[model samples]
Target: MPENVNYYHITPLVNDLERFFNKYRLLAVESKELGIKLETKDLATFKPFPNKIYVMGSLKLSRNRKAKGILIRKEGKPVLNYSVASLWEFERSPDRIERSKVIVDYTISPKEAIPKEYGNLFTDDFMLWEGFSGMGKGGGRPAVFEGKPLVLPSLIRITPDELEKEFLCRNLGGIWTPKHKASAENRITRLQTFGNTFFPMMSRQYFPISWGSWESFRLEGEKYPALEDAVEPNV
Candidate 1:
């Protein structure tokens, strides 16, 4: 097995229990209405649930106009003429519209962070250094290599505030290359401008396990609780 394949256990916060259950109930009701033949026992076991249909209440319906034309030859004295005509069509319309969208994921893990235990799997090229000891002044060496930080994959269960802070501090540097400095600055500005609203919007929604397929649910406005509230019922 690959060293990076670390299994993560995610638990939702306590406050979100009621809402999660409610959504599950709604899903069950909808499934029944569609005559999908869901097994209660399987659902109760927390098997993968089928993809639930959700209305993007935040998005407005869009209208599209379509037209068709046909070419025909008309009788002429010396040359043939072409005639074009338009076909009848209906006007398109938008559904619902909103300002933002919420993304819910069961698992949230760093795409690039490496786990400490898997240190051997990585080479010097992938390592990041910090905390320079000897530099400038006399003949001094460059920055020294420090131990690698532990990065592991886990379920999404952090508070928005914490995430925002971490995002801001992640790129702070004592000595940075031009590329690193620019990237850090961009991230800092983005977090400062949208940190509060951004983190909550990115919160992932948790659902009951079902034997079926996983489904996503969308709601109008930002009425749902933050992802931090989404906790497993038994937990």
Candidate 2:
């Protein structure tokens, strides 16, 4: 269970989001691992596949858009729009998003920080010496926001240099890298951004686990109160 999860709320110019996601690389990888079959020709045939998060349909708001992520329950609490990479900040990162609920102290709500001037698009500045996203330093030493204060989570990677730059740039670097595109194969390219050093660990960590493993129904009813039991098995 990831302790911290980050969301990159991208409201792109792409028109057919469903088509884009169906053929999207990362989604495909996720589908393949989950035994999900998606076809661009069949939209209704899809479902996130009965999967907990099948695309959820893109979010929309006239003045602003919404995209929630990695929704999980921590200690029976709910965590929405969290970062998977940020989980490293959790003292006990079991990679179980379901086990851990959102910690108010940990979230710095980005809605207010939306860089609308940058085109009505922007995320809150969760970049701290140790926030949910990666760190930043700007210079070789990583500035305050860029500086890394702890280990990185599996789905997210931050290099020594990445931790130094300011949030003004870099957080969404992967998307521009062509790897994070809607095309799908971009998933590899997206993960490839981790480079050789971190990608190895991240690759292994991001592997698809059985669905019920990462998902929990505590909020949905099948209750299990022991949220953070180290003795419990990991997905």
Best by TM-score: 2
What are the TM-scores, per candidate, against the unseen true structure? Answer: 0.16, 0.18
List model 1 lDDT by residue over 28-64, tens digit each: 1011111122222211111121243211111111132
lDDT of 1 at 12: 15
Index of the highest-lDDT prediction: 2
Q: What's the distance in Å from true for residue 107, model 2?
A: 15
Q: Which stretches in model 2 have alpha-carbon errors above 4 Å?
A: 1-78, 86-176, 184-189, 192-235
Per-residue CA lDDT of model 2 for 1-235, tens digit only, reads 3533212221111112223122211221112111222222211111223433222222221233222222212232222222222111111123311111111112223312322211111122122212212212110211222333422221333443542331122355432122223231112223223222321112212111101112221232211112231111122
How displaced is residue 17 in candidate 1, in Å?
10
